[model samples]
Target: MLQVISLVLENKPGALMRVTGVLSQRGYNIESLTVARTLDPEVSRMTIVVDVDATLRQQVVKQMNKLINVLQASDLTESPAVVRELVLVRVRTAQESRTAVLKEAEIFGGRVVDSSTEGFAIEVTGAPEKLNEFIDVMGSYGEIDVTRSGALAIALDARKLKLQPPVPTKAGVKMEETAI
Candidate 1:
């Protein structure tokens, strides 16, 4: 199973390295990771995706918390969340296949984010399975290149989950659905 672990660490050198090193030392392969600053300048948040069995994952989470730099770590796979991944794809399309490509893109909720004489660059965001289906369907059209962003997850709750010094949320972003 893939566990998406979120971390909040101080903005300093070697902090991220320590966390990654702990996982690497344990031979856990990271499938994806996304790190960014919250509203605060002193802290940064990270979402890490790794595939590990439940029992060992608990151990890993314990070890992660032990790290001085790690403020929070959780197995979001156990939470009710909506997961999304962004894909930027460039496809080789001829004049004859242009319409077909556009149609497929629309069917997949993708848009032509970029275009050139060579081809088009499509942008799509969806669940992992849906993204896989979109990528698979694009293969028949022509040569394709793709890049994906790591998964980010937010838990839904009345209480603010702290991975570091807590950050506040404004109005409108609710707790009903946690986006992963």
Candidate 2:
């Protein structure tokens, strides 16, 4: 099964290499990896998709957490999350078939980002399956070039990696539970 592992890491040099090194050393295949700066400039968020069973998932999460730069790591495979990918396809379009390609692009909520005498570059963003369908349909037009952004996801609930101190209770005790 495919699992999405979201990790929060300190924005420091060699952090990314450390994380990827761990996976590589373990011989785990990464299907997709997307990393970007978060709202906090001192932190970065990494969304990695890997094919692993339940036992391996736990082991991977554990190994990720052991990395000094990794602040938090969680497997969101079973969580309610919004996952998406982006694909830009340049399709050869003739005057005769341009309309058909444009119509199909619209059907998939894609936009013609660029157009030229040779082809039209359409940008599409959605679930992976939707992008696959769009690519399969556009293949008939003859693909000139294609670029894709791997899957990125976030949980629907409020659970997030944070550094705030624990909330205090009425009895002056700190709550051990997480915000989620």
Candidate 3:
């Protein structure tokens, strides 16, 4: 299953490397990660989306908690979280497709942040699928170039949701390890 992990760590060089190294060593695929300085200069916050098994994820969380620089580690997957990914897409445009392009952006709640006859850049913030759907439609109008921020989530501590089921397997199968 995929997990959204938030880590508060001491701000310092190579700190990101260490955290990512742990995931890599365990053969976990990091879907995306974003690191930025927190309100305090001495600390940084990292949000990472990783594809990992439930039991392994627990161990990873425990290990992160034990790290000297890591102050807090939380799995927000089952929480009532607000998650969003920002995407900037550069689309080639021409007179024939300009109208089509703008209309599509409008449908996706995106703005044409930049534009020229040759091409246009649109910015959209929403769930990953929403951004992807916008991009998919762009192909008919023109070629597309996309860049997106890693997923950001705000956990709903008091409004947590029921945990999700494990990643589905083929032939109507199920996983032995349940996501905590």
Candidate 4:
């Protein structure tokens, strides 16, 4: 029942606050949120994950689109998209467990970002499920301190969300083919 809702909003003061406020006021719990400036400095993209059923999912998107600074909002949960999260883990490593931890990290495509006699700091990025599995495996090694960057997602279909407008020519004419 988790939905991935993506929004393109004007990068203006209170833009983020307004969007979040709407959700909070409605009493919807946001599972995760990731926001960053898009290629256009004037715009920002936000990826929000909320655990809502189908009926509430539609309501969330509808409310988002009604926000003043919001350009577009789409639920990407059922769409073709690439989603990922980054996790940094510091795991207690003893001489006996160091090799096992390193090997597990290697298998999960995690990099040893930092290492000391007591522990190893590993950086891993992948689908949320994959990261969950890696974290579970790492937990067996010893105590772990974890930091996660919540889900960030983008639709694969061009029509799902468009943050950029058509390009303008020197003559001040918008190019049709350049629309994205």
lDDT of 2 by residue, 74-150 (tens): 88899889889999999996778888999999999999999988879999999988999999999987755778899
Instruction: Supply the global lDDT for candidate 3.
Output: 0.83
The window of 10 residues in a row where model 4 has the poorest summed lDDT is 171-180
Per-candidate clash tally: 0, 0, 0, 0
- Overall lDDT per candidate, in order of appearance: 0.82, 0.87, 0.83, 0.90
Best by lDDT: 4
lDDT tens per residue, model 3, 1-180: 589998888898888888888899988889999888878998888889999898788899888877766777788877778778899999997888888888888989999899987889999999877877877888778788989898887676763223335676654443444432
- Work out the TM-score per prediction: 0.84, 0.86, 0.83, 0.86
In candidate 4, how many Å is residue 49 off? 0.5
Using lDDT as the yardstick, the better of models 3 and 4 is 4
Look at candidate 4 and give me any clashing residue pairs. none
Off by over 4 Å in 4: 160-180
Q: For candidate 3, list the clashing residue pairs, or say none.
A: none
Q: What is the per-residue lDDT of model 4 for residues 38-134, given as tens digits with 9 covering 90 to 100?
A: 9999989999988776777788789889987999999899999999999999999779999999999999999999999998999999999999999
